[model samples]
Target: MEIPLSHFEEYIDEPLLKRGLSYFKNGFVHEPEEIRPGDYEAVVEGSEDYTVKLSIRNRVITEHSCDCPYDMGAVCEHVAAVIFYLEQEELGLTQNTKKGSIKKAKASSSKPSKRKTLAQQVDDLLGKATHDELILFVRELAAKDSLFRDLLLASFAQYNPNESKTLYTKQVKTLIKVARGKYGFLDSSGAEYVSNELSSMLGLANHYIRKGNHKSAFFICTAIMDELISALEYADDMDGHLTDTIYDAFDTLATIAQEDPPEEVRKLIFKYCLTSFSKRSFSGWDWHLNFLHLAAYMLSTDSEMEELFKRIAAIPKSSEYEVKKAQEIQYDVLLKRKGESVAQRYLEQNIDNPSFRARAIQDALDQKDYEKATALANEGIEQDSGYPGLVASWYDWLLKIAESQNDTERIILYARYLLLKSHNPKRDYYQILKEIVPPEEWTNLVEAIVQEAMERKPYYRTDLVASIFIREEWWSRLLDLVKKEYTLDQLAKYEKLLAQHFPSELADLYAERIIRYVENHVGRSHYRTACKYIRKMIKLGAREKADEVISQLRQTHYRKKALMEELDNV
Candidate 1:
C-alpha cells in the first residue's frame, strides 16, 4: 500500500525494469486506461501484443498479471511497461502529440515540442511509403541481416511449406553452428541463446501446425530436436534450457504424430526417436527416458509396441542405476498403454524397489483408494527400513494423502514423525502443525524441535534453531545462540535478523567479528574485508568500539604496508 514511484524498482528485476522503461519511452505501451479506482490495463507490443493488468491499493502495486509466456515468476516486461506508463501519467509526464501519437509531455516554456519517437516516426513513414517502396525496403533490410532473412523465410515457410522446407533445415543448421561456439562449447549463456532461437523456430512450427501443414511442422520439430541433441555434447546446459527446448520440440512431434500425420511423416518421427534412443551416448540420461516415452506414444501398431519394449529390454544394463531407470521407463510406458490393473501387476513384480513401491502408492492414491494407498505407503516405509530418506518420502506421501482427505488426526500423526524422524525435514511440516495444532500447543511443539536440534552432538543445524527463534521473535535466545565465535560471513547471515530485534547484541557481535577479522589476516583483501565489518559495526552504532578495533589493528600491523594502505583507505 502507498507505493511511491521509486518503489517500482523494488517489485521488478533491474534488467526487466530497464527493458520495460525502454518500451515505455519507445511508445510500445498503448492505450493505458484506469479501468477502475485502482486497476489499470494496457497493451504492450513486443513480438506480439500482450495484455497487462495491474491492481493498485493505496499507492502500491498490489498485483500484476500479464498474458505473456514469460516464465521467470516475476513481473514480465509487459507489466513493467504498463507500470512505467502509469508512473509517467502520475508524474504528469505523458501527452499525446497527435491522434494515436504518444510522446512525453514537455515543459510549457517556449521549447519546441519534443520530437516523435522512432517508433512513431517509423509508423508515419511506413504509412506514407508506397507498396513497392515498402517491399524494396524490406528486401534491402533482409539482405543485410541473415537472421532477418531466415525469420522472413521461416514466416513464409508456414504458408508455403513445401517450398521452404530446405530453407528451414538450413536455418536450423546455422542456429546449431552459431550456438556451438568455435571451440565446440556452449556455455550457460550460449545455451540460453540457442534455446531462445530454437523456441522461435518452435513458434514457426506451431504456426504451421495451426495452418494444417503438419508435415512441415513435423520436419521442423524433428530437425530442431536432432540439431539440439547433437549440440548437447558441445554445450554445458546445466540450467537445462536447451534440453527443455528440445523436449518441447519432441512434444510437438508427438502431437503431430498423434494427429495421424501421413505415413511417411509418422515413420520419419518414429525413426528419429528410436535412432536417438539407440545411441550409447544418450543412454542413462533423462532425455533417453523421454525418448522411450515418445517412441511408445508414436507406436501405432501392436507389433511396433512389442518391438519398442523388446528394444528397451535389450539395452545393456551396465549398472544398477541404469537397470532401475530402464525399469522405470518400461513401467511408465506400460502404465500409459495398459489399464491400471495391468500396470499394478507389473508394479507389484517390481515392488521390492523403493521407487516402484512409491509409484504403487501414488497409483493407489490416483485411483482414490485411500485405504490401499495408506497400506502401500506404510508397507514401503517398513520395507525401506535402513533408508531414512526413502522412509521420509513415504511419510511425506502419506501426509499429502491425509491432507487431501482433510484427516487432521492422521496429518498430525505423520507430521510429528516427519518432524522428528525424517532425515531432511521440511519447513512445511512445521507450518502444517502450526495451522492445525492449538496455539497453546504450538509453542511447546516448536520448543521441542529446537531443543532436539540443540541436543544433537556438535551443534546440528543451528540455522533451523535460529529460524525458529527469529520466527517466534525469541531475540534473547537467538542472541545466546550467536554469542559464540562465528566467522564474519556467518554473522552477516544473521545480521539483519539480529539488527531488527536485538540491535545492541548485533552491534556487539559485529565488534567482535571485526576484531577477529583484523587479527586473523594481514593481506590487503583481508584488511579490506575487516574494514567492511568495521564500517558495518560503526553503522550499527558501535563507532567507539569499531574505532578502537581499527586503531589497535593499525598499530599492530603497522609494518604491513598493504594492510596499512587498505586501513588508510577505509
Candidate 2:
C-alpha cells in the first residue's frame, strides 16, 4: 500500500494534477496535521479555503474527501494538493516545523540560519542607491532582458498614454516571435510555455486595471487576444492552454467593458470583436460565437447594433448548419439587447434547426413555461430521433425540466428512454431511475436493461452496463460477458474487480491465459511476461496449475536457453 508518485496520476485528471503540483510548489497547502494514525488533514488555499482529509492505510491513500464543491466524481485540486504535501513529507523533500507547516529541509543542517532572500537584498541595495544610479541600473537591466524590457514598458505605458497601444502591440509581436521555433511551429509543451508567459503579461494588464488605467489594460488585453488568435494556427495546442489563456484575456476585457469605459475604449473593443468575427480563419469555432456574444454586450448605440445585424445577415449561408449558427448568434445578440420576448420571437422566426429548437425549449424553461418546454422538448426528440446524439441532448433537456417541476413520472419516463433507447448511456440516468423507482423494482429495471443490451446483435457491453453489474455484485453475468468479448490481455486490467467476487475463477482465468501465452510466444521478454502472469496466477490460488504449465514448457522448449533461464528464476 506504499503509494508512489506515479499512482496519484491514476486517481486524478492530468490538468487538476498539474494545478495541484503548482499549488504545492507555491506553498498553498498549509498546516498538515495527523488527526490520528493513518489519517491526516490540511487546508488548501484556492479561490477559498478548502479542508482535505486523507486516510492512508499502509501508506496508500484509501480514502480522501474535500470540502470543495467539485462534483466531478474524482479527486479535486485541493485534495491533490494535500496529497502532494504528504508525498513531499514522505520523500523527505520537506521538513515539518514545530508549528505544523512544512518547509524545504536543509541538507547541511537540521536548522539553517535565516538570511535575506535575493529580492530583499536587491531592495536593500535599491533603497540606498541614488536616483541617477537607480535609473542607470534599470536601463542596464532592461537592455539585458528584452522580455523584461517589454514588460517594463507595457507596465508604465499609461504615463505615456499616446504610445501605450504601440508599445503593447510591439510586446505582442515580440512574444509571438520568441514563442515560435525554427520552423515556425510550436509543440504542445511549447504552446503551454508561451501561454504561461502570456499569462504573466495578462497579470501586468490586470495591475494596470487595478491602478484605474482602463485604456492601457484594454489595449493590452485586446492585443494579446489578437496575437494569440494568430498564434493558434502555428501551435499544436491540443491541451487547450493557449485557448484558456485567450479566454482569460477576453474575460478581463469584458469585465472592464462592463464598467462603461470611455468611448474610445468601447469602440476599440467593438472593432476588435467585429474584426475577429469577420475573419474567415476564425469561423467554425465556439470562440467565434463567444466573440459575437461579447460584441452584443458591448453594443452601445442603435446604429452600432444595426450594423452588427447587417453584418451577420451578410455572412454567406454556405451550408444549412452555418446558417443556423449565424441565426443563433443573432438570437443571442437580440436576447441581450432586446428581451427574452424578442429573442423568442427571433428564435421562432428561425426555428428550422434542432439547435434553435433546443434554445426555444430552454427559453420556455427560463420563463417557467413547463408546458411549452415539454412540448418543444418532445418535438425536438421526435424530429431528431434518427440522430442518437441529438436525441440524447433533447432527452437531457426534458429530464432537466421534469426535475425542475418535480414531475416524478416524466423524470422516470425520460430517464428510462435515456437508459434504454439512447446509444450513449449516462450513469446519472441510471441513478435517477434508482432514486425514483421503488427499491423492489430497481433490480427488475436493471435486469430489463441488461437483458435488452444482451439481446442486441453481438451484445453491447458498455461502462454503464458493467458498472450496474459490478454495483449489484452480479459476478456471474459480468464474468460471462467479459470472457465472451475480452481477451486475456484485457482481462488483466479487471483482476481487482474479478477477485472481489470470483477469486478461484480469476485464478483459473489467469492460469489459462499464462499457459496459452507461454505456448504461443518464445523469447526472453515473452518468457518474462509469462512468468509475471504465472506469479499472479499463483497468488490467486493457481499455484498447481502454474507449476504444471511451467513444467510442460520447460520440457517442450528445453533447447531455448533464455526461456530455460527465466523459468528457473521463476
Which one is best on lDDT? 2
lDDT tens readout by residue for model 2, 1-570:
223343776768888988887787777888466555555678998898887866676546765666677767557888877777767744465544546676783331101214543456677888999999989988999999887787678656656748666777777776666656445676554676678887887887788778776787888887777777788888868779888988889889888787787788788888778878878545766667666777877888878888778768877776566667667777877787888989888888777678788777887899999999988878887887778788888888889999999999989888987876666654468778888998988888888888776666564645556777877888787787667643567677667888777877887777667767777887889989988877887777778877987888888789989888998887
What pairs collide in candidate 1? 2-59, 3-59, 3-60
- State candidate 2's TM-score: 0.60
How far in Å is the alpha carbon of 386 misplaced in model 1? 5.5
**True-structure RMSD, every candidate:** 14.0, 14.6
Q: Write the per-residue lDDT of candidate 1 for residues 121-167, one digit (tens) a residue.
A: 67789999999998998899999988667767754565663554476
Task: Give each model's whole-structure lDDT.
Answer: 0.74, 0.75
TM-score of each: 0.57, 0.60
Residue 464 in model 2: shift from native, Å?
5.7
The true-structure Cα RMSD of candidate 2 reads 14.6
Which candidate wins on TM-score? 2
lDDT of 1 at 498: 81
Candidate 2 residue 62 Cα shift, in angstroms, is 31
Candidate 2 Cα outliers beyond 4 Å, as residue runs: 1-161, 178-197, 232-245, 280-286, 314-329, 352-356, 359-378, 393-417, 426-451, 458-473, 488-501, 514-539, 546-570
In terms of lDDT, model 2 sits at: 0.75
